[model samples]
Target chain A: MPQLALNRLRERGSTERAALDALLDDVLAGTLSTVVDGKPWVVPMLFARQGDRILLHGSTGAGALRHVAAGAPAALAVIAVDALVVGHTTFDSSANYRSAVVHGTLTPLPDRERAEALDALSERILPGRNAEVRPMTRQEQAKTLVMAMPIVDGEFLVKTRSGTASPPDEHTDAWHGVVELRTVALDPAPAPTSTAEEVPRSVLDFAGARVLA
Target chain B: MPQLALNRLRERGSTERAALDALLDDVLAGTLSTVVDGKPWVVPMLFARQGDRILLHGSTGAGALRHVAAGAPAALAVIAVDALVVGHTTFDSSANYRSAVVHGTLTPLPDRERAEALDALSERILPGRNAEVRPMTRQEQAKTLVMAMPIVDGEFLVKTRSGTASPPDEHTDAWHGVVELRTVALDPAPAPTSTAEEVPRSVLDFAGARVLA
Candidate 1:
């Protein structure tokens, strides 16, 4: 597929490879959309950014994954809202967000790379988790399917909106500002079957890094 | 298109109308996927849930919006992750999330209803702002395109995962639990051009409601 040119709000769109990589790394999950039998099918999945490609994994039996493995064109979108831009008119009110959409074909990772891809995914979810946790068994690896889509330049588009809303035409003592929004990690709740009494370093680190700014 | 059956992890799938409604209302933005000329295109958009339909608005000149208005089959997905499940193994870890996918065709709202739909979109981004802000201008309404997709019962699916991960076999004193994640609203930053010194009630109420929970 060719690069998607931003037809509207061109100021907010970019084709920078760095920006695309940063967005894929910042957002741990994305909505993967694919064409199956000429119909659009979209599903949210957890993904990890691996170099120039984003890795997506699911059960081998998943119908959507199967369609992608069969060379269906796919598009993955990651969006993160930074703030709410409040203006003096309903038309000016909007959100400040970073959105990236990647268009490509998915290729199933070979069996030899599945374990490493899984680790990258695990690390994305929880940094330093692979070393702390037990390795995946062969049976488990066999049941999972890992796929990668190349993040070629010009194959993705990144659009971002920031700053305050456009100044109102006739200001009249109306409040206008930006309300920053962030995803924060709260305290952990131990599972009933957990034997460990204290939170692990990986969990603590992940939580600590996500404190409200 | 027929309803998508959950081929894998059937236990996590749901067809309840209430669940689908709740997920759509909770997530302010979603990724809209549409097939264009036998290829997939996905874009992140801010939407409002109006009764049994989702209202999506954008510039009238947007290419994607035009495609949808031209009778493209589209799927909008809203996903909110509640927590990160930590387990003793990488394969066992996952995220607790509520995901809803609405599959339908987008219909452009009539010109008479455009202003109302824009208000709904604004209210979703900033509650109670309609009363405080001025009404949208005629030109603003003319330049904007508002489309609605019916959230029919059988055409949508909601899947959710909650609580902690499944217990690990042969435990080795690993920390296991869920780290709750929430989208929080921080202190508002007034625009430099604003004449008002005090924050508006609408912003305060919205921020207060989004504190860590």
Candidate 2:
């Protein structure tokens, strides 16, 4: 679609589905953009990728989601910043990042599939905790809204920038390099008087994997 | 403005300006949302707060910035994810995060103020590096676009969720706590065969300061 076209820095944009899915799976949240009541609105949402579609969760009463379910066009963007590229000149400086942008109309999941979507979301976020946590109640399921936006129709763009700064200038010779940026999981801080439970293998993996890098 | 009202989870929204500016200063990037050709578009942008306004930078040729400059109503959202709350039940699990959403029309900076704005942005993101780097050429200045969005008009909302997860059901006792998430600076990776320069004090401060927490 014309909307998915990357106008500037075209070299950074990618059409690969693998890169798009990998980026969607890597970041915890994305900014969902939609037109609501004749104005643009954006909100941060916790999301997960299941099969070929992205699952977004929110309260059924959210105005943005309500507008989205009513067929307002939407865009979801997930970005994972890897490092800061410091260049000799200010114009050449930038950041190394992986970004996935998807445009489509959201299809609200049926009531019967909300429970499964929730479990899948839990599994994607906290890998092994789906089985450990108590089952979601019928009332709880009724209160939530799950949205699925399929990855198709060339509506997605994945762009990444990595490596050291290299500006094509002869006079500038300050320091040029990249300082890595990463999202690291720290030790879990338990609530007061709560039992010290064993940390799950998934938490360990998430902490050690350097997934954003 | 009714457009800025937080329809769902209205309790999390804030009207205080100090809290709003503090959040605007802490985060480095935000998703700038605007309507282009009657469709919603969201793009990640590096931004800085200058007094009561937010400064956003991009190439002059960028389509999204072009749209914003053309008077499309915009929403800029900055979110810092502090931790992952792992709870006894999946339903109770969530994240501790601080978010600020600003709705406004962008005002393009004049040629007279572009230099000052560019310096302000560099100082905000890289801290001390502005002094170390060479001055931008007039050609470079012409190629860049700086737009400022004022934080006035009651079109702003700051929402925050912090603390450990507390599942409503008492019977289920899985693990419960928060795993902190942070953006840390690793050792600077200098360009190949480049002279090693000391990391700037601003960068050091950025690396040391837990801005999200």
Clashing pairs in 1: none
Candidate 2: tens digits of C-alpha lDDT, residues A103-141: 998898999998998888888877877766668889878
Clashing pairs in 2: none
Tens-digit per-residue lDDT, A93-152, candidate 1: 777888889999999999999889888888877888888877888988888888899988
The top-ranked prediction according to lDDT is 1
The alpha-carbon lDDT assigned to residue B98 of candidate 2 equals 76
Report, for every candidate in turn, its global Cα lDDT versus the true structure. Answer: 0.79, 0.75
The true-versus-predicted C-alpha distance at residue A192 of model 1, in Å, is: 1.0
Q: Cα miss at A162, model 2 (Å)?
A: 0.7
Per-model chain A TM: 0.93, 0.89
